[model samples]
Target: MPYVNIKVTREGVTETQKAALIKGVTDLLVEVLHKSPATTMVVIDEVDLDNWGIGGLPVTDYRRLAATSGQGSGSME
Candidate 1:
């Protein structure tokens, strides 16, 4: 059995998007590890934008800046 726990900021993810994320990861695990998708489990823990920081800036605001500038999200600093 494969089990994965993912933590992501809540700003950009929707409920279906979250499911797709889990599906994609689980697919890989099942294919590569020969695990059963039915038995595998995936959990996503959402955090507030204020709780996730990148390059000394909040991920919430960083996403806005990235969209405006057409830039990649800032890296951890």
Candidate 2:
């Protein structure tokens, strides 16, 4: 069996998207590794912004700073 873990910030992911991810991952493993879809496992983990960090700062704070600094879009959307 193949196990895949996917982690993303808990901001705006939907159930439909998560389902798609699981299906896609399983399909990929089946195609590439010849794994059985029935035995492949995919887990999605959503982490809070406060629990995730970037550039030595929390994701929430980093996003705020990035917005104020006129940097990148600073949003997943």
Candidate 3:
């Protein structure tokens, strides 16, 4: 079995999106590695913004700073 773990910040991801992610990951493994989709496993873990960090700062704070500075969109899309 192939195991995949996906971690993202807890924001506004819907159930449909999560299901799509799982299916996409599994399909990719099957196509690239010839893994069996029936046995492939994909796990999604959503962490709070405060618990996730970048540039030594929490994600929430970084996003706010980036937005004010116009340096980043602070969007996953």
Candidate 4:
């Protein structure tokens, strides 16, 4: 069994988008790892911006800083 956890900021995501995410993740697991769709589980958790942080600052603040710094990708990579 493969369990996948996806976390995103609570930013007005639609049910259709969530369904797409679940399906995409399951498909990726099935293709790459040969996992069974019936045994694969994907969970998505929406977190508040204030609750998700990076570099000791909330995500909102981090994004703001990133925007100002011209690093607007919002990715920690």
Task: Give lDDT: candidate 4, residue 39.
Answer: 94
Please write out the lDDT profile of model 4 over residues 1-77, one tens digit for every residue: 89999999998889999999999999999999999999999999999999998889998888888889997885542
> Where does candidate 3 stray beyond 4 Å?
none
For residues 1-77, write the lDDT of model 2, one tens digit per residue.
98899999998899999999999999899888899998888999999878999989998888888889998485552
- For residues 1-77, what per-residue lDDT tens digits would candidate 3 score against the true structure? 89999999888889999999999999899899999999998889999888998978898888888889999765752
- C-alpha RMSD of each candidate structure in angstroms: 4.3, 1.7, 1.3, 2.4
Error of 4 at 27 (Å): 0.5
Question: Which sequence of candidate numbers ranks them by lDDT, best first?
Answer: 4, 3, 2, 1
Ranking by TM-score, best first? 3, 4, 2, 1
Cα TM-score per model: 0.67, 0.85, 0.90, 0.87
Better of 1 and 2 by TM-score: 2
Give the count of colliding residue pairs in each prediction. 0, 0, 0, 0
Report the candidate with higher lDDT, 1 versus 3: 3
Model 4 regions more than 4 Å off? 74-77
lDDT at residue 29 of model 1 (Cα atoms):
94
Against the true structure, candidate 4 has what lDDT?
0.91
- Whichever of 3 and 4 has more lDDT, that candidate is 4
Q: Which residue pairs show collisions in model 4?
A: none
CA lDDT scores, all candidates in order: 0.82, 0.88, 0.89, 0.91
Clashing pairs in 1: none
